[model samples]
Target: MAPNDTQVSFALAEPPVETAPAPAEQLRTRFGTLTIKPAHKLEMPRGPFGFSDYTQFALADVPNQPASQFRILQSLEDTEVSFIVLPTAADNEWIGTADFEAACASYCFDPTTSGLLLIATMRRDTNGQVKATVNLKAPIVLDTANQLARQVVFTSDAYTIRHPLEL
Candidate 1:
């Protein structure tokens, strides 16, 4: 999914006496408390590759790192279930290729408007240094217009599940 660059504003208005107070919109996560808005919520029909049980998620910006390339795909079903993702630009070399377009098309996604996010995994090396890698083979494709998403797997060998990050 793409990084949320737009700021959402809520109007300050008192509720009518006849209506009850709205349910809390705040979601407490490992990252912190996030204001759960409809705009930021995503519905995964098939969920991720292995986590089909939990289909609902929220695309949240990394707390205290607005300029960072990473985003959090927080599972609404389970507060502890979350994944770090990297949004791929439309002009990205691999994403702009015909193969990538075909992959997206097979899943009924429009390459031009669909947003792609690579799942990131981090590990510690022998030297006690941390390294990060992204799964290029399997990416979460987001239908931004409908707030729907699905994890698509590319059959081509060009992509790797553990594409190392520069860090």
Candidate 2:
């Protein structure tokens, strides 16, 4: 049959069985009804400073228009607590700054790294008007390989501990 034909049928293929093994369990967390996949988990090596007690967190997808927002779901025993996730700057201009870029480079995070700078939102404001701030000085830097992470503190006075999320 021609490529345009939708009625073409071929039955020579053996029953498809385990052609691709399941993805590694990357983001395993007992949050919500579903157990999140491993890829979604952000590796917190020392865990969050204040939240050192609970290390593993699931960064789940946030449902809404404007795709920037996400849910940083934390597991608290049988209960799951989720925080809104937002970037420090709406635009990545600050990343180009010498100090910021240098800090990232020291951690071997080049421009090609799939690094995500996320801040846990305090409230779930559907209106999206709530003040979204990021911990600039102490940012969570994750090493995509081996799922390792560390919260590094940048001494640059250029940034702030809480910077307003501007569009």
Off by over 4 Å in 1: 1-24
Displacement of residue 6 (Cα, Å) in model 1 is 18
What tens digits encode model 1's per-residue C-alpha lDDT throughout 30-55? 98876665566888988897889999
Candidate 2 on 1-167: residue-level lDDT in tens? Answer: 11122221211112235566345333334333434445555555456666665666554444333243434444433234444444232125444356545655776654234243555444446787565566667766544444444566777687677666543
Residues forming the 10-long window of minimal summed lDDT in candidate 2 = 5-14
Candidate 1: C-alpha lDDT = 0.74
Please report how far candidate 1 places residue 165 from its true position, in Å: 1.2
TM-score for each candidate, following the candidate numbering: 0.79, 0.58
Inter-residue clash pairs, candidate 1: none
